[model samples]
Target: MHHARSLTALLLTVLTLLAASACASTTPGTGSVPAASEDGAFPVTMTHRFGTTTIEARPQRVVTVGFNDQDFALAVGVEPVGVREFLGYPAPDRPWAPEGVRGKQLPTVGSQDLDLEAIAKLEPDLILGINSYIDDEAYGLLSGIAPTVAQTADYPEGATPWDKQTEQTGQALGRSEQATKIIAETRAAFDAAIAEHPEFEGKRAVFLLGSSAAGFYNLGADDYRTGWLTELGFDVDAKGGEISYEKLDTLDRDVLLGEGIAEADFKRDLVQQLTVVKEGRYVGLGAFDDDFAAALGFNSPLSLPFLLDIAVPRLAAATDGDPATTPAPYLG
Candidate 1:
């Protein structure tokens, strides 16, 4: 009987040790261990406009403070502790955020009026500010909280191409290969759309936004949003200059893209006078769903796929240049 009791105690001890080992192996970023890369090497260094950030290990607690980095984070399988808040976004995640992170309770961060102290409290191991217009002072503070990455200086604000932004975000998270695949997939979709609509080639396109105060705003040629047009074989007609209400007629293009009727400064006389409008080459993007306009503004990978599927049909219709016909299939 005494010998049997000894064996039982020994078995109990082995089971306890096994449980402890399992808990110890839990991944910090996600509860489960991330899938293997080419070799499982880490401690990667990423360089940005601010400087270089060396991530000692895969970040367990990530925070994204920009328009699109959170989408990249989610796409690359890292759930961020916090994400930047966007205008008209009722929840922490944007409507177009990845399915895994949607409806999450992520804290909101970033913006000129950013709550720096709140971000600090999140205790993030990594902070991604790429695709954000983060100046030096903000960078200094965020770097103090953790290793931070910011947008490349080469691109203008809100203009980082989606592929560059995605690849950089992937590199930061040690998922470069995955990022490349995502880029290729998105590129394939764009290519397929172009293949389907050969008329989009050589078309002059412009995407414009407006507000009551700003009157009319157009993205520069450098803007990533403009890349959507270029990638689809359209020749973007961006002037890379400030377009005002007085210059409303200056939007010379075969295909005119705008957010809303009010934001596009579609004043009755102004609309009638514009050549694109008169030619029915105007695509009032808000006519489909105002959120499509917002997604274009955000310009993230998560939103890109959704935008591509819907925007292509509308664009193809407008490129026909029939004055009486609207992009009715999508407009309704």
Candidate 2:
């Protein structure tokens, strides 16, 4: 009886050890333990101009502090939890966001002002900001709440190339591959469109903002307005002088693109003084209404395709002089 009892006790001890071993093996950081695979989707660590940030998990809740940042987030297939409203722009109230993120529910976080309190309440995993919209002081505050990224270059804070900015933000979010694909796809679409209608070839074009208050604002090459136009095969004219809110009595170009200029304004005596106007070479782009300017305000990788769709057709028409006469498309 004693021998049998000893064997039983030993067997029970062995069973307990096995169970403990199994538990340890399943737990992380054990030598014999099975590791939980990241399933090829590991969180990324991103270092930007603002500071270092680690995204422990893919961000589902995001907040955009600037107009373009919001667009970039949407391009990567995620709508922001919060976004800034653009004043004096057509931001239509809708069931979802009005533009690129049209189907997603998003809250307005106020315009041109960073709503830290509102952002904190949303409990976002990530925040997107441009250098112009966010400063170092703001960055320190935002980083405490969530990982934030700022633009690489300095351009009036909110102005950066949509492609570069999108690429940077996507990398931070562990969606670099997705960003690359989006860019390539967009370029492909532009190529296809240009092939279908080749009237945008070798034509010099200028994008100007016409304001009753400020006469004209010619977009520089670095500006988003003319940058995209340059991409669409429009030769951007160079204005070497300092840019300011000034009226010009002369206009010279194969094509002239202006937003928010009334037909009556174009017909005014002031407009007739311009050489291009006298020659009938001016092609006023009435499409640059409130909605279009609002769209421009939020230029991002996601919105690039849409902008191309709108601007390219009109530009091609303006440059070629006729809808049917398709010129050779710009290859550069």
Candidate 3:
């Protein structure tokens, strides 16, 4: 009986030690681990434009306030308890990235008008706003609610590069390996497309957006959408602003792309008669869903691969210099 009691005590001690080991996480960031991320890698520290944020322990409940941050988290198996919506844009994750939000209908937090109370109600342990355009005042409020990670001051306020944004989200979640894999895959796709289309090299390309009411605007090389064209080896030097209807001729380049521009609007501005359009080098951005547009804007790991499939073929057709080929037949 005494021998049996001794075995029981030994088993209990082993179990106790195992339990203690399981919970000893929250290590400081030393960059010692590989991109796959090390177990117990937190508390991870990331410095953005606003300041530095260190996530203590792996998060259970996260809230993504950044417009496209959700997609990054979703790409690496972290779904937020709440997500920011963009003016009726279908949860970008649903179509572009379904793995993270698969069958999980996440709550809409807020857009430009952040709902601090709603976010707090979600009880998020981590608040990711890397693309949220969060100001100092807003950052204070969010950090008050939970540890908030804002966009890198490295790029324009709202325009963090997709790869860096992915890595940032990964580090915050303690899953850098998954982030590295996705980034590598996406970059490989771009490289493959570039190799296939040497003609795309050194060509001038710019993406413009316009409506009959809003006129037209240009996205320069620095813009995320235009940056994709730059990745494909286009010489994009757009100044990144409005392109008046009268000055439409200024956008004349090797390849011209636009979103929401109607054939009537082009005809009204006599843009259809431009050399770019006349030579079949102009490509309208997407189909009715504007998935292509969302992919261009989100420009996240999930969307870029999706974007490549839609963009490469249309760009190839448009840049082939065959006016007979239609880049977007549905648009016409």
Candidate 4:
């Protein structure tokens, strides 16, 4: 299946809309033709929640307005001129993505506080906001400067599947073949890990992150934070709520996985005595523990391998069903 049937429909609809005279079915990520040449790839059009945007030619200067869209662009080798900063974390220079910006000075475009003036100054031909929260008004304003694309209706905001995001970015950049390769490689790594850890299946698990005075919170189904864990074949039980320290016992499961809770945070008697913890099956990481924390946010094709490299080993050690095996030596 070199081309996805659904993506083919999208390409056909767009091509028919523009009345493209003749072409066979397109490569899924590559638009209009099978492995379309840079010139043949456009006037390619992509439909999103904001509407259809037709790239008349291959984009020379693109800007990514979504917090996570830059990773998708970087995955496909399109170095965005400007990238929206996500959660105060530096982009391009991020630990999870070493080859993304590669020391090119990419200006920040403000994540939630999008600076339209800065974006317009960059003079981008294509604006990618596929993982963003650009409303109708903002989309119109961005479109005024250049063709602007917001998130598609198919995916919930901030929770687009990594593969789909990569595909659209590839189509937008006319680099679909490269995007397909990256996706296959990333999935293969996860698949290999799944094969190695058959014990992970038929088990219960929960993922929690960070803490507050009120309680520590777990992510919901739509949150990208838990997507990888779910894919690894665990019945990832996302509670979708916060639990106070006193009620931490309820998070008990075969394996407790999470990020941002320090080793000290688990020192409490209530946490230490939990069945999962006593069995040495908890793998929690500090916010600044390593690059895994930031990679969790990106969750793109480029960042997936970085996450798996660190996570799979730790999780495997924890879930080996042996109490003597310590998941992380630092996590007391």
Model 3 lDDT per residue over 1-332, tens place: 01233333344443454345446553422222234445586888889877898888887778898888888987777767788886356763446676535555578776657766567566677899988876676776678667899887778877788889999888898988888989998899999999999989988886777656446778786677677888888887756887677777887888888787766786664677788888888777743347777777678888888888877888999888778886863231
TM-score against truth, every candidate: 0.81, 0.72, 0.84, 0.84
lDDT of 2 at 321: 56
> Model 4: per-residue lDDT, tens digit, 234-259?
77654478788888887788888767
lDDT of 1 by residue, 35-141 (tens): 55423537888877878888888767788888667777776666777777665454344567666666666777644455555565556778888866667766766
Worst 10 residues of 4 by lDDT: 26-35
Candidates ranked, most accurate by TM-score first: 3, 4, 1, 2
Give the deviation of candidate 2 from the true structure as CA RMSD: 16.5
Task: Name every residue pair that clashes in candidate 4.
Answer: none
Q: Is candidate 1 or candidate 2 better by TM-score?
A: 1
Prediction 3 global C-alpha lDDT:
0.75
All models: lDDT? 0.69, 0.58, 0.75, 0.73
Error of model 1, residue 116, in angstroms? 2.4
Alpha carbon lDDT of residue 215, candidate 2?
Answer: 56
User: Ranking by lDDT, best first?
Assistant: 3, 4, 1, 2
RMSD from true fold, candidate 1: 12.7
